[model samples]
Target: MQVYCTKQHANNGSNRFCTQCGEPLPLAVGQVIDNRYQIIRQLGQGGFGRTYLAEDKNQFHQTCVLKEFAPQVKEPQDLQKAKELFEREANVLKKLQHPQIPRFHTSLQVKLGNKDFFLLVQDYVDGDDYSQLLEQRQSHGKTFSEEEVTTLLRQILPVLSYIHSLDVVHRDISPDNLILRSSDHLPMLIDFGGVKQLPASQGFWFTKLAGNHTLLGKKGYAPEEQLRQGKVYLNSDLYSLAVTILVLLTGKEPQKLYDSYQGLWYWGKEINVSPQLEAVLKKMLAYKPSDRYQTAEQILKNLPLLTATKPPTTHLTKLKTMIVAPGRQRANALVSKFHNKTQAVAKSIPLPVWIRPFAVSLGGTALVVLTGAGTWAVVNAVIRSVTSITIPSISLPEIPQLPNPLGQPVSDKGTKDNTQIISRRQQLEIPEVFFIKMVDELFYTSKPELKGRSLTSKAEDTALRNEWYDVASNFLDKLEQANLSTATRQKLGNYRSQDYEIWRRQARAGQLGNYTISQLNKDTNEKFDRLFPGQQRGKLNQQTFGQIWYAIAADQVSKLKSSN
Candidate 1:
């Protein structure tokens, strides 16, 4: 028997890890989890846990997704915190009840060998994520049309509105999380791992649980506030959603499309969309959360009515060509079929005088005359009169001079002037109700900045420079609430005190002998050089290196604190 790893590498059933990548392969085929769900295959894995395709044997072989709670944290306190977050995910899913959202089944714990494995079962959504769909489209040299994307937004925005009404924020909204269902062709919002319930009031504070500070969301797709301070609001999801649409439009990731230095999105020239749609998308992708649309409802209300593009030749011109050309027999057959149907209906019930004149006149017009000047106008007038029947209007080309029997050329400039008049008339034909609806759906734009209230007491900048981990962490939190600049927020977010602590532990265990400074990435190495310009990189072991790294980070924090 063979089993597939999370990366979809085939392995022998008895193998503990993937042969190709060496990633731990937890569940083997036919392994019964919680005596109910039998593991079929590993679907995917992330930082949180591995998700598996499973069969609920007790429930008539129903397919479901079993999300395993397998955080890499080793400490008991961290493990307990991870468990609480895992349970919170299940609770969030249980509260959500929408057709577009996968239904939460149950959560169970089972012992696999000596370790306790926790599992969350949810209704298996059978479809490809938007990321996969976009890839498929790109492979064929195609992308989603504006109409298709607008329809997608219309379908998914209501789902966001529903969740937001329940006070639940989907923190992670990206192409990977949106699945296009095979059954209905509608997108389903999946993966509630980053789901956070909004506090009832600004004053109501919930106790900060362990692992709560751990950033949860994709980096490039997540807003600055979310990536920097782990702060997620209702509009945070909206920001990610806008990034997702931009990715689909340009067939490029958010990182590539956005100018991080200039803080501007360069998506306008890449794809052709309406000015209205572009404006709305820009607001949604605003740098500050307060500048974005406050709610999904506002987005829906402001969304413009999508209009079809004008064709080079009108439908009436095509109909005229079809009537006069060799395909005249086909057109006559269609008209004859309609005439016979009208006759059959007339025999059962008397035709009205208005309808009878139009029905009889259709037969009197010769095939050549039907393609002539006044005939097109007569057909259009009849079409407009039958508004009660709800028939679609046929677009007509501008009237051109009929060809003379002697075949004299007609003036082209006269035809050009007539086309402009017809175009203006068509524009005026649109109902006033459309404009009224657009006016009624104007967007709300009164969102205020989310800066918290000022602190009465202040801490000295020297305290942050003391090289204490507890002090630096508390200072970072205070700086976040103070509404610091983007550069300052980024500096604080990238601070690697955690990395220094890991090195400290490795040094205490005498494992520093096996490590080298060269293993650090280019960015980290550059940062190290800037901090300790004279220090020898080769001689800096984990113990000595951690000490210097810690001191440098502390000093930088102190400088930022004093400047603010």
Candidate 2:
């Protein structure tokens, strides 16, 4: 096992000192910590401790990131206090659940040689951070476009909104902490080591925790209040995010863009953007916390052309807390809430078999109609578990008679002619909400425990494959029947095909199941939250589950572009 010393000299695992420099090595490759994670190499170091890339041997040897907590405190009591505070903060960090944020697994306390080390384990995100991406662009004599930065802000602000609503401040939102995930080409927020939680009800706990005076956050990116007083507000992250955008836009470091003597930002001279975006960025970079946009949602609302981008499904609000139960009770609760909410607009709409999970299932038949324009509709059928528990055998339901929204006669194939459908659709001016729901519901389904269980027989596998094919066919048939505009039809059809192909591929690999609708939105968003929270200026607004559909589709498009 190779280990590097402070002077960058390599040494053997058993060697205490480097053969050339005689510097001590804290850890070595192949060293297992806490009998689970095996260190691969050192990633980096900061004021607190170093980061290491490791693999969890117990979990199929999955790669993960390990952050060590080695604070510089002389007194033993101070070190103990710091460790206690770190553990408490880790507990809070564990609650963060978002696709863009790395999942915090657990914390550990272990001894290496004579020192006690605390470590936090998290899922390893494979991607280059924005800082690194900027350097790559600089090598090509280019910088991030205003459109790219605008897209970045629009995507990441919702993440900030999610965490900030839970009363947790990232405290660090620089380009270095924002990674562009390779899997989806979406900007992922990483490195929560500097997160600060300021729960209003736990004032005393916060006071004691804040007494550490660790001075978190980067020097140039952090706002004045955070750097000087060690105080963090939700908007503190916004201030740092704006700085990052300027850095990416100008291809200049933060210090170069700012005039320290005059206490002003002169990044505008380096690059130009739209007046609306410039105004939003300027407001976000305000020196004083109160003078800036208060929350991430504020910045999202004021962002130029955000409303024109897509459906009104922005998830910038606080989610209502929900309880997750098992069996029919859980299924009923989810379907009941969605049924009542969408009843007004969704009149006895015969939902296709594939999207039945997004509507209310009456015995064997599923019927649904959505109410609010942006409301996410959920429908779950109570499929009794198979007694053998080997492979689920869900019998496909027949397609019901179609209800012509145009009140036109349907042909034998269960669809009006394209001319009639388009003419009537134009007269009514109906948006593609149904199409959006169809694509988005694919991801909202729950995952059944199929781990370590293979199909009992090849016949069962073939049966499941046929079921998936039938579902895809039904989806295409539904799209054809809708006769949407060519652009909408192709976009939604591609999404459905993308998802269907993935499931089919998983089946070929012996990893497919008849999963039901997930009660927790698969933990994407909080359940039972009001679909709409009004259009107040500064308040948070909830995003419908349907929004995830487009977000995924957009991500797929981005990845395709990157690959090209």
Candidate 3:
């Protein structure tokens, strides 16, 4: 039961003035105004008013928020004009009936001690605001994860859609205005002191209000037009929402997330997330009203996998579901097949007895054991199979149900397939000679039959190189298809531009020198050592050099077997 002065200094309930700053104190606690609502304590202070936690005595002591409309105007006509604006805006907000939004009760004016108090009554949501939640996380050296932010956006966008459909725009949409409700863990929109109806019939009445028209939003969060000219568009709230998300993600203020000099949000590069999500966020934070997403529905549509009607049945299905891009589906199918086999092997093995007791304690949904080949187990919580049974690792030879890269049957035979020959006149985009030359540098390994020789002659080298190309072509054909997700495609593109393309260019120009060790990733570095055990980088024969690059590409493509 306390009041605060204009300087936000707390004062005793009985004091009419601040003892420290000597400014007029706000409504004292225990003071019942309008004989129905009892003042409790100050909750917050804003540009237009001070919010108090109050009790609706008429409704069995239920808690509510009373927002005081304290405009700094003295003239009789101006005061009357402010009252009309407040009532008009409140009536518009009263039409909103969203569950996530606090229900607006009514506006009341009461005279207590030679002064007037205009109060807005709303449902008091009992939970921490996002700002407070962020503070708690920051104290522990953490911020809202990308997943949390996306979930928040998914929930809050619908509320925005509901309100915008009613032609109401929330001018202020910072993290402070949103509350994570304790009753249902849903984000609740709490403030409407700055809500404005956007119908053409309203004729921009907000501009006429005194002491609060330009004070609707916080700096850095609000877009330029809204802050500078007191003009707000449907997308203005979206800009503020993006800023709020950036703040939650980086735990930094809006000023730090954005670069005022460059007039762009530099936070995108700082955070590691999907490029698709970054693009959507960037568009929402666009400086121009027209450049931004005009409606929440538009943003939902453009969001990364948010509007998907159903989940993917398989890794291949997921890749095809996404928009087509070059090299998108290239390594996905190959990686999925390999990953599934390894996962099956990893799961089918028997668990140790020492860990068995710990696993069974986790409950029934812990581990689901699927027996036999071509099947996999899902690890839910802990692995606690009571019986000790050993399941041998399964080898899957052919996936007949799935189509091959070129619509041919996948052979049970290993990588070397001499019968699969490319017809030159088949109008194939891939040149057979390209693969032949790509692997030409690979010398033959020492065979038991060819005892003393460790390297193949020119003619023997040519035959082995051609055989290797046939296998490489299978991967190339899939990569050229148009069904990969943008992320997968971009990853493959980087491998080509930064690795494969550089090697190919050097080899083709006959200027291949010592390969750049610094440019090689960990996998490539290891593979290089295995291929040329005791040889220096610049001293390898052309055959071994070609084999190393091919192995590098194969290894990279195989790594994607686990990627979506």
Across 1-564, the per-residue lDDT of candidate 2 in tens digits comes to 344565556566566545784333566556799999988656666544567878798998777889876543446776676677888778777888876689999999876755566788998765557776676566446677665677677668878888877787878789889986533345789877674333323221111223325467888999888888878888988999999999998988889888889998884586577788889988998888889999777787787653333333211110111111111110100111122221122112223333333433456764332211112222233122222111112111111111112111122243323333333322332223232223222212222343222221133344432333243234445434533333233232112223333333333433223321231123212221222112121221111122223233333332332343
**Candidates' C-alpha lDDT:** 0.50, 0.51, 0.51
List the candidates' TM-scores in order: 0.51, 0.51, 0.50
RMSD of candidate 1 to the true fold? 28.7
Q: Mark the 10 consecutive residues where model 1 has the least summed lDDT.
A: 326-335
Predicted structure 2, TM vs. truth: 0.51
Instruction: Note the residue pairs that clash in candidate 1.
Output: none
Per-model tally of clashing residue pairs:
0, 6, 6
**lDDT of model number 1:** 0.50
* Candidate 2 global CA lDDT score: 0.51
Single out the weakest 10-residue window by summed lDDT for candidate 2: 328-337
lDDT of 3 by residue, 1-564 (tens): 344466657666566546785444667545787999887656776545568878788998777889876544457776686678778767876897876788989989876555555778998875568887676567446677664566577667877877777767788899889986533344778676673333333222232222334546789999998888888877988999988988988989988777788897775465556678788888998888999999887776666542232222221212111111111011111111112211222212233332233321124454322111111111111111221111111111101111112211123333233334333202232222222222222211222232222211134344433444454454445334423332232222112222344334433433333333233344455565664455444333222233333345434433332231
Question: How displaced is residue 403 in candidate 2, in Å?
Answer: 36
Q: Which should have the higher lDDT, number 1 or number 3?
A: 3
Error of 1 at 504 (Å): 43
lDDT of 1 by residue, 468-502 (tens): 22322332343334433332222221223343443
lDDT of 2 at 130: 79
| Top model number, TM-score | 2
Q: What is the lDDT of residue 20 in candidate 2?
A: 89
The residue pairs found clashing in candidate 3 are 328-484, 335-561, 336-561, 441-542, 441-543, 442-543
